[model samples]
Target: MKRFPGKTMGLLWASLLVCGGAAAAENFEQCKTRLFNQAVAQGVAKSVATEAFDSINYVERVIELDRSQPEFVTTFPSYYSKRVTDWRINKGRELLKQHQPLLTRLEDEYGIPKHYLLAFWGLETNFGSYKGKMPVLSSLATLACDKRRSRYFTGELMTALKLIEREKLSTDAMVGSWAGAMGHTQFMPSAYYRYATDGDNDGLANLWESIPDALTSAANFLNNLGWEPGFRWGREVVLPQNFDYRQSGYSNRQSVSQWRQAGLTRPGDKTLPDSEVSAYVVVPAGHQGPAFLAYPNFRTIMRWNNSEFYAIAVGKLADQIAGGKGLSASLPDLPAYSRDDIMQLQKTLNSKGFDVGKPDGILGPATRAGIRDYQIANDMVADGFPAKQIMQQLKVVQASETSPN
Candidate 1:
């Protein structure tokens, strides 16, 4: 899933005004009118566009959500814990058994394991207990007018319009997430248009109501994304006490043999299984945190949802669903950095010429890389994870009051 911006809703509302009087002055209905015309120009039938937009209202709540995804503030451990709870795990197991025949067929056809499919299904909508209730058309339309990511959401809105026409779905029935991701496996409009399938062979890819269709569509997506068969996403591993922290990250790919030679082992000090598969070490938290030896399939998971924490949670949850033990090491309770602190850290790094990109208060790859460079320069563990210590060291703050003991 895309990580949305995280700032005060007031700031987002103000951003519209800063674009000049025309945009700032436009009301919701005016933006809706323009979007409807755009839809018609883009090949949607005028009647279809009109009916879809006729009663659609701008969803202010959706805008608030789009500007505040949790990945920006929550640590990986916290995210993982909340997402991969026992309730979810048990529910996944029950659903795995309940949908075994259909899932098995999907697995055979698409080469994606049933557990992974179930994990995605569970995580996406909690096994369909709560597929979002917001009207998809209105949500997409509202975002299509929002300038933060207007182009992207505009395309999604068009795709959704096309999907309704092609699938013969009732316009009023098209309800989903605030971002317009729909069905049991929360697929975006483009993904739905491209990959949704009639797994039950009922002549309709009814993702919203059909478990078979939803699971099959999800499986088809992974299959198209180049999901490697017979490969686990990755493993939680034990690093040697003197292991080089600089070697951590998705960019540092190495063969299992090389990794073992460099003192990487499976949890409990077992040697990495002999294989030709190339993998990377990802230290999401830092040197003091649990490490993972992520494989190629991990990247495929990242394609499904770009966040490393999301991918890890899915992989681990799938493993547990398949009767494997969870992580061997406990996640450390790290210090929490507020949005202001992150923006200041990014500003400081940029000012020092580390190039963290514009300070949006999101700890993305560029910010992490900048932190790593700063850490390397200062003889600190270059794990790239932000901390109170790093902030103080860079003189971005005077003290480490938020440091976790």
Candidate 2:
């Protein structure tokens, strides 16, 4: 969950990379040879480097995944519903009670809450049910050889080799997602080297085989990521009917008192806490969807996975595992826009000189900004949400059309 940049959903398809077409590189043998030599140069013992290389193979599907782009961006409702399930919550609660003594100790030592740890544990591999089966060295080497992210992944591959060399771990024993994230927490090699903990005090930080190691390592990871000790990740809040949509984003930071004064209230119209902790408004699904007063801890959660949807899921799951209720607001049914429709919208926005960058059909920040600008210019709601009316007005779709896609 921590350093496989972009979406963590890559874990889902990472297994598909196990077998496929031949290497797309000019010479895969040469690629492996170079990687082996580079590993040796990076201080991995030659024997260990050779052993690692012997286990390495070209995972051709990783190349395709690396170069591919998402067509349709997933909505918050879709994402939240999938991860924050009743079963997951119940399981997490069961685990929390089962490990209460250990979790309480971790919270005391690391200043991280027990429920948040369980949230991370549940989200990143579902309490160790599956931590991927892709060969770590092969996948890292395959990605390192690719020109797109060669430099960064080369460093990661080097780190992985170093980990193998240091720990004397068998290459066959080292497996993870196609992106090379390992163990229950989906940590990259560097994270393992830096933050892996021996919570059970058995002397080794074995994330794959030890629950204590995995959970404690996760706590250390979050602690180092600047988790606010006592604060909740964030909470769903109600925006006033006349709340300005333009002020709704991470860029707009204000205190709880300030937001309370600006008409941000709790779900049941309860006033916000008078405490002066800083928070920002994140309308992840835009104005019509649930809004949250994302605290500093929310930013820390982003450091874990770097996705608003992921962070929201973690926070909400933690809340439920601690016996809290669900979100008060119902998610509005969004227009089922295809990749082509969004791509066309992006093109339209760019043509009008809104600078949404190249159209990739993903509703990234720039596209949201472009939509906001267009909406504002047209005297529309300017929520930056790419709502049905906005897309239709932009001619990305016809007003008479209803999508079943």
Candidate 3:
């Protein structure tokens, strides 16, 4: 899972101890004694636990690392195109050749196909070429100290500490991503506790140093998430003429049979199967672009990352890894509008007695309904999606109404 930025468990506990008055110190001492007395807590040897904690300082540089994600705001094509480039594909192929036996064994054991694993590895760190340079302990501990989501961060921090106590990971060796996600596939502290395994059989699930453990852990995670071995995530679908534009969001789910009845079909196929599985259509742009009928697996991918564009990018990368061509659908010509602009548009519509719902920047169903109402009232095409022209018109109307002649 992509680790959300927040306080770490260590910082939370520390703050509680420091700020909870004299009682806090007493409680801390008691808890420390109890933790130390409990044998085999984090699976680490007892000898290194106190010493590691005593010397480590929660560095503030970790904040910079967490915030420096330049690629997060980029267009999907730009971000994905770079990740799925020939260099990555060739490198992935090379890694596959070198580790075929290990990958084959993992696939057999975990029932997760190898391509998805490769896709994650290739996408995450370019096959471990760049796991991250930050110290996991410092990064996690710093976030924990900040008291941002102290409860959650404290849990993760405790987990990390437990890992240290168990000797499963050496303090010096536990380096990882900016947000404290370690190894090739970027397993966070919580994930390390749950899914990490000793694939190389070195007595520890050392994701930083061992490729086998990282890949195995990743496959284990996906398998546990109900990934189907032979089933595809999604395929491009063709929308019929005069299709309801509002039915393009992620929440729109209909069975394949229902979609067929509604005149939706796969891009190249004429007939739709009468399968009971639910699916939804997403048109990244307006009607001018290619569309897709996303299946349950697509939602699963979103569970890994909340962004629609990110999930689609990962799916595209996985297809590329499997030697399939990139998305055949053309993106809509609509230049992306700023998120702020979208929010402002929603606010305007809501103030005008259109129920845009919550004024969130997301162009969701309620927002679409509001846009449709506005369009109908103005005698414009009720296409639902709020284009630049609609926003401009709203601004002009607002300005005129507010003007002091």
Whole-model Cα lDDT per candidate? 0.86, 0.86, 0.72
Once all C-alphas are superposed, what RMSD does model 1 give against the true structure? 6.9
How would the candidate models be sorted by lDDT, starting from the highest?
2, 1, 3
lDDT of 1 by residue, 17-53 (tens): 6664445336767888788888899899988888888
lDDT, residue 346, model 3 = 85
TM-score of candidate 1 against the unseen true structure: 0.87
Q: Which candidate is the best by TM-score?
A: 2
- On residues 1-405, what C-alpha lDDT tens digit does candidate 2 reach at each position? 446645555764564443323335446788888888887877889988887788888887787777776666688888888899998899999999999999999999999999999999889898889899999988998888888889988999999888876665778879889899999999999899999888888777788888898889999999999998889988999999988888877888889999999988999989999878989888878778898899999999999898989999999999999999989999877766778888888987787778899998888888988888888888887789888777767783432233465
Deviating ranges (above 4 Å) for candidate 2: 1-26, 396-405
Which residue runs of candidate 3 sit more than 4 Å off their true CA positions? 1-47, 61-75, 333-336, 357-386
- For candidate 2, give the lDDT of residue 328: 94
Which model, 2 or 3, shows the larger TM-score?
A: 2
Q: Return the TM-score for candidate 3, rounded to 2 decimals.
A: 0.79
Q: Per-candidate RMSD vs. true structure?
A: 6.9, 8.2, 8.3
